[model samples]
Target: MKRLILVTLTLICAAFTLHAQDTTQQIVPGRVNSASNQTRPYVIMISIDGFRYDYAEKYHAENLLRLSGAGVRALAMQPAFPSLTFPNHYSIITGLYPAHHGLVDNTFYDRKRKETYRVGDTVTVPDGSWYGGTPLWVLAEKQKMVSASYFWVGSEAAIQNIRPTYYFKYHEKTSNDQRIQQVVNWLKMPEETRPHLITFYFPEVDHAGHSFGPESEQVRAAVLQVDSAIGKMADAVSKLNLPVSFVIVSDHGMTNVDTQHTLSLPDTSIVKALKVAPGGEKVLLYGNNEEEISTAYKFLKQNENHYTAYLKQETPVRWHYGQEDIYNRIGDIILVAEPGYAFSFSKRAMHVGHHGFDNNLTDMNAIFMAWGPAFKENTRIATFENVNVYPLVARILGLDITQPIDGKLEVLESILK
Candidate 1:
């Protein structure tokens, strides 16, 4: 049960792996539940990456449908603009959009730091300085409430000098059984060391959506496997008889791209001159020279095929990106691919399924379902933004929001019992 300890989780990072992932549970010593929080209801927030809002009904994910049916089910959960994995997960956990949270995309460039933050980079992934806003686990720990994470965007890092009381560095090799047993073990601990808030993540659905397209049989298989895991986890947790609430969500939805004719800028020289941070459906290009950016934007706009180009400030107002880029992590030039379109570099083969498009698109909507002692049973609610999840979980675990965030508690308060 010492696997209840936590090690390095990045603001964007899991699994048992081949390269020696430290499976040791890192305990943030001297931390115990504050007396006032000792009896606070527990929260298990789960993210099934790329589990679209309609996947439950479309693919008949029985466990999710039944579980959410017994509690609260939302029409949809909107991902923040860009609709990528890391930024939206961080948005859900931090209640801040990618710009405000400083994770503008799964991979983004920071002019101030003169560095690129890529989700796959092990070196920068665990560095807390790259992340902004207080994660829920950080908020809980700040108030002396023990928290744990199976895997979360920032759980590996010492955000505000705090990691969950128990955590695993990002790795996928760890089996579902191992992950489930670890959660059970944590709950069996003495009250002082037990985690009141725990975050769990699954990447299979997203991986399948990316590799085989959202409608493929492979994706259905992935969704079913994740649904089965959720069912097992819920059953095991229920036997504990604790005041536990389960909040299940996804980072974003998936869509099929025009793989046969992927989008690319006509001017290779202009693209080559800028530092590029490319997402499947969008691309951010940065350079110190204003003229070069203008040239690239103009060139792309004039030759636009299945994509649209925008100067940093000219991006859609609803996106709350560009002009709101407080960290200047956004690029000087942005190109967003149209629905059914994706960007390609050097004419490389593109994946069948893609996201990172406008978050407002119906195809980009994710799922949200909450069930537990603290929620209203059989309640059906309208669609809401992923950011609001931060406040919802905070309200459930009785953690205070230390900073102003985009999420408002009222948006999700009605779902509570």
Candidate 2:
């Protein structure tokens, strides 16, 4: 009887082992949890640098207009303060204000490294230490979802020590077609290696806006060119019958720069001791000593018509700038040029267009539109800030976002199906 009992126990253990194997085989590849009943969805986020909110409306971009009607489109996307490329792009991905992300300016001094980080500088752009907050790609990769980036401001770096499964270093000269094809190739990867999240960047629109004014014919051509690329990608996705959510956005808009209306300070003792970094409509001033600070402040105040000056402590709460000064990177004084005005230290050269103005100005607004399996059709949403984009991405992918980000998922809730 004892031998019989032993044999029975062994048979029961074998049956339990087979049941567990069956359960494991039923688990979906992309879905980490079965509770959501969601297959991992594909998300492609594209950034058109310096593309203004009104470009599609003004240029008659059929593709963009179609996307707006087919999915959800914001009237405008209010960029964070400084309204520059690097900061706003990073803000959209991280769902944090530029102040919170620690990229307060496109060009900033790193006191810790004693080096200045500037755009187009290969060494600085790829260093992960300069970036703060976890971006969407980094967050997705943490959850075991594959990710890729064609080209993004900080994608080349391993932010928070996490890099996407696939990413390419940014090269401005890469043709738009080549870039789009690469993204298509990544999406075509076998299910075992496919990227669930991807980002693509295009600087042509911004380039055209800056070189020729936003209203110029060149800008219109650039807008249409990018529209064509979008149409092609959408077609490819449809052909594959792949479930994809495509998000298109821009960093900031460009406005006409008044070549005749320039603000130049005289070479006083105040000016000599002051270090001025001018970003078209915005400027940052640092001083060598208390005397320099006093002199520069008084000079700027005496001529307040050209620009408004603010101390680091007195920066407007709405601007959302100069948070905590943990890096001591924010300058002692901040200057914002009045609309239709430009700032210069010595000689002022005329640029066709410029940004980096107050965020409240309509001219500084960017573009936002999304279409895919998860969004509502024929949805037109009111304008929202770009910071909220991060949470939307997290929600679409069914990922857990545990970080302290400022984005609110409810802001875009109406657009979700």
**Which numbered prediction scores highest in lDDT against the true structure?**
1
For 1-417, candidate 2 gives per-residue lDDT tens digits of 000001111111111111111111011234332322236888999998888999999998889889867999999999998888888989999999888888887766655675666665556677898999999988887777778887677887779877777776555555777767777887777776777888987777887777678899999999999999998888777776788999999988889877776775555666656655546677677777777777788887776867898877788888778655556777778888877787654343556677888988898899999999989998888999999999998898878997898789999877888
Each candidate's clash count = 19, 0
Error of 2 at 154 (Å): 0.5
Could you tell me which 10 consecutive residues in candidate 1 have the lowest summed lDDT?
Answer: 1-10
Full-model lDDT, candidate 2: 0.76
lDDT of every model, 2 decimals: 0.84, 0.76
Candidate 1 lDDT by residue in tens digits, 292-357 = 888877877888888888999999898999999999999898889899998775444567888889
Q: Which stretch of 10 consecutive residues in model 2 shows the poorest summed lDDT?
A: 1-10
Tally clashes: model 1: 19
Superposed by TM-score, candidate 1 places the C-alpha of residue 271 at a distance from the truth, in angstroms, of 3.4
